[model samples]
Target: MDLIIRKYGGTSVGSIEKIKKIAQKTKDDINNNKKILIVVSAMGNSTDELLEKANQISKSPNQRELDLLMSSGEIISSTLLSMALQEIGVQSKSLTGFQAGIDTNTIYGQAEIQSINNDRIINEIKKGNTLVIAGFQGFNENLEITTLGRGGSDTTAVAIAASLKASVCEIYTDVKGIYTADPRIVKNAKKLDFLAYEDMLELANFGAKMHPRSIELGMYYKIPLIIKSSNDQEDGTLVCNSKDIKNLINKGIIMNNITENRNRVSGVTSEGNISKITLKNIPDKPGIAAKVFEPLSVSGINVDVIVQNISNKNKTDLTFTIDDKDFDKTIKTLEKESLKIKYESIMSGKDYGKISIIGSGIQNAPGYAAKFFDTLSKINVNIEMITTSDIRITCLIKNDDLDKALIKVHEVFELDK
Candidate 1:
């Protein structure tokens, strides 16, 4: 029997009616002779509501307690879905993260999955029962409940699929598939039928809905992942290795040669929750860069898009971007090291956003950067910082101009077509 794993987002199981609909879908799958495992996220905005309730009680809720509280959302959804399935005459079982044997590190919030003991999952499958596992929450070495951060459920689904060696992992979301740009932001943005895992990873990291860790796990295990919408029967995007994609194109199943030059530009993405910090007049000495970033790293703050200017009079300026939520913590960390680092001044700006274009071999493509900058120039948008990789080019711009920049850039690359 073929084993299949399907993951539904919160919106998919937001209400009783939707849960019933999912029950019908699962019944159909069971009748098709496929052993099914379902991973469900918390229903609707319940997780957010939980956080709001916690904040109402305390300014800084304890991380361990917050994880335990937040994990209940998925548990509620999973159990409800299981009951819905049984009510519809299909045998099913609901299991929490710990019950399913998801082991992780000791981190309370943002814990990484260390391993999964699939014995229990296999036992349920052997009984011809549909297993509905709660997503995002896992147990640490100490057996304490820990929650994966944002998009953690996606990670959970992929990790389970990998461990079980399932045929494929399906991620059902609100959108039909991954697009060249956010469809709402670019009216003409086109849906990509397939994507290389590397491209998908870049897109997710820059701000796409799919999680980067999920993509990374999928890539590592060579698992095929499909992203589609639960509300509709439309085909979703397939993410896999480039070689696998090439085989599909050669088979004529995919009409467009995604590996070709015309399709070189994969997508344009923008992240608005970004802030830049600058340390001015720092002594440009050996190990200065290390000294400046080590504290932020220790504080669990991710610094991105760093640029250090050439030394002038043995001094230079260092600037970097971080997520808005970590800005205050980053500032605090830097201040504590001020005496040790001896910087002239520290300045931070929260009105910045990053726009990135992702594709394969983009760095080798002549005039791509020129065309990118030229398009922005035509719209009078100023670029603050520039960063690039073999497959992506990112630019920092004012948050106020993000929408305009995205639209113009999407058009320039003709991604809408």
Candidate 2:
């Protein structure tokens, strides 16, 4: 039987009614003779509520215990969904990540999946039982429970699909599909029918609908991933490598024969809660860069969009962006290492967010950049820090102007058509 891997996000399985709806969908899949294995996230806000309860007990809970406590949310979801499936006359079984043979590294909060043994999963499927595995978690080498950080459920789903060699991975979320811009913000934002893996990777990296690691897993495994809506049976979006793209690209893009917007760019994505930290007046030297960033790296804080000013008088300034969640931790870590790094002072701000446009052949074609900047210029939004890959251009702007800038850019790039 051809196997299919489907993952439902927390919002998709938020209520008993929603779970029943999903069960019905599963029944339809089975009726069509496709072997479907599901991965499920915790019910909506359950993980956050659990974290809040833990915070009520202690400001800094033990990492190991925190992972153990947080993992229960997904277990609850998996079990509940399995019960729903059974009640609806679908034979199904729920398994924790470990029970499904997912093993990870020792990191408690953000463990990396090391391997997955397909023996139990295969056996359960062979017995005609659909497997519903808890997402976002696994066990470490020491057999301790570990969570996969923020986007862990997506990671779990994709990793499992890759490990089991499933035909394709479907990510069912609240949104209809990947859009030209967030449909909530840009009213005219159009849904993209297909995306190259590289383009999607850029989007994921710059705060699109996906987690970078999950997209990376999909790209590396060569698994075709579809992002679809759980609330309706809409053709959401297909993300795959270029070779598998349907039809041929005419005029730098193709969108299932949609001719209104034919451009190299795919989408506009935005993110808030950005914090930029600058180490001012650092002694311009060979190893200063390492000294500045090494501490943040060791602390597992993600730093993005780095900039180094020109050296003058044997001193220079270094700036980088990170998610504001790590602001306090980043400050403390840098302050602790300030003397060693020998920076004059630290300047930080929480007033910034990023807006980005991602697509294909951006560097090779200069018009995209000119148009992007011109669009922002017209809105009078000042760009702070700028970062780019061949397929993406990201600009940090004042949070106040983020919405207008994103919408204007969407219109300017013709992504709304």
lDDT of 2: 0.88
Alpha-carbon runs more than 4 Å astray in model 2? 245-262
**For candidate 2, what is the TM-score?**
0.95
Best by lDDT: 1
Residue pairs whose backbone atoms clash in candidate 2 = none
Cα error, residue 208 of model 2, in Å, equals 1.2
lDDT by residue (205-267, candidate 2, tens digit) is 877888989999999998878898999877678888656654333311223542322467888
154-273: candidate 1 lDDT, tens digit per residue: 999999999998867889898998999988888998888888898999999998879899999999999878888999877678888767766545643334555422478899999997
- How many backbone clashes does every candidate have? 0, 0
The TM-score, computed over Cα atoms with residue i paired to residue i, of candidate 1 is: 0.95
What local lDDT does model 1 show for residue 148?
86
User: Estimated TM-score per prediction?
Assistant: 0.95, 0.95
Off by over 4 Å in 1: 245-262
